[model samples]
Target: DAGVTQSPTHLIKTRGQQVTLRCSPKSGHDTVSWYQQALGQGPQFIFQYYEEEERQRGNFPDRFSGHQFPNYSSELNVNALLLGDSALYLCASSFGTAVQYFGPGTRLTVT
Candidate 1:
């Protein structure tokens, strides 16, 4: 019955550094999706994972990647971070095509 959860509610990083964000899907969910929300902008889908494999990806560069575990938890990794990478990284969970439930997200500040 637990809802989706994310770690390190806030994070700070420098340009060129990498960061990894974590997420736990809601109970009974088998899919996880990652999103990035810039200041004053709506969430943009980064990628989605189901069955422990990436099911879909967005228009992001190769620096963005993700992994989903058997337990339905997931991790998002961003390499060669840039100033533009600073944003709220959101994790959403869904059971099939149903509505997605989002976590509060990890605030990433790239300087």
Candidate 2:
């Protein structure tokens, strides 16, 4: 079976622009988490979605949001983007706190 997959592996946006990143979880996974990774640093948890509702969030501002679909796919939406938002956005799918399967992350650049 295939692992997690993401769309638009690379993305470019300007400050104040909004972007949406999509992720299709591995088969049978129902929960999804989003993370942001800056250069030279590990991934920072953004938020998690399960049962179509947000279950947890990290230190990110309200500009970051997510949704989990009934089918278990998820989306990460960032509003009022800033240059500081430039980073690799990752999508991880798992089963209720189980080992997460991560996708090849979307690299976003904000100018």
Candidate 3:
């Protein structure tokens, strides 16, 4: 039972640059969602993917985009990143409406 995994446990990026984060959903799960968590803040849903298409999205801008592969893995790409983009990018997965299991996350530090 492999849980969700993310790369580069930590990262540093400059303002205005772009960054891509990857994720592998937990075994037995078919949906993936991305979230951003800032210091002392709760996770904010960016978007969710099901059937290899975006099923739902939050208040983020177009700069925040994602993709889900047939294998159930996903990736989040942020363009024109800003200093505020510095946060923990979490990947969550679920089988249905059930609770989602989260990964350790890739910390993006925008300077």
Cα lDDT tens digits, model 2, 11-109, are 999999999999999998999999999999999999999899999999999999888888999999999999999999999999988999899999999
> Over the stretch 1-111, how does candidate 1's per-residue lDDT look in tens digits?
779999989999999999999999999999999999999999999999999999999999999998988899999999999999999999999997789999999999999
Q: List the residue pairs that clash in candidate 3.
A: none
What's the CA error at residue 75 for candidate 2, in Å? 0.6
TM-score of candidate 1 against the unseen true structure: 0.98
Q: What is the C-alpha lDDT of each candidate?
A: 0.95, 0.94, 0.95
TM-score of each: 0.98, 0.98, 0.97
Kindly list the per-residue Cα lDDT of model 3 for residues 42-92, writing each as its tens digit. 999999999999999999999999999999999899999999999999999
**Runs in model 1 with CA error above 4 Å?**
none
Model 3 ranges off by over 4 Å: none
- Return the TM-score for candidate 3, rounded to 2 decimals: 0.97
* 2 or 3, greater by TM-score: 2
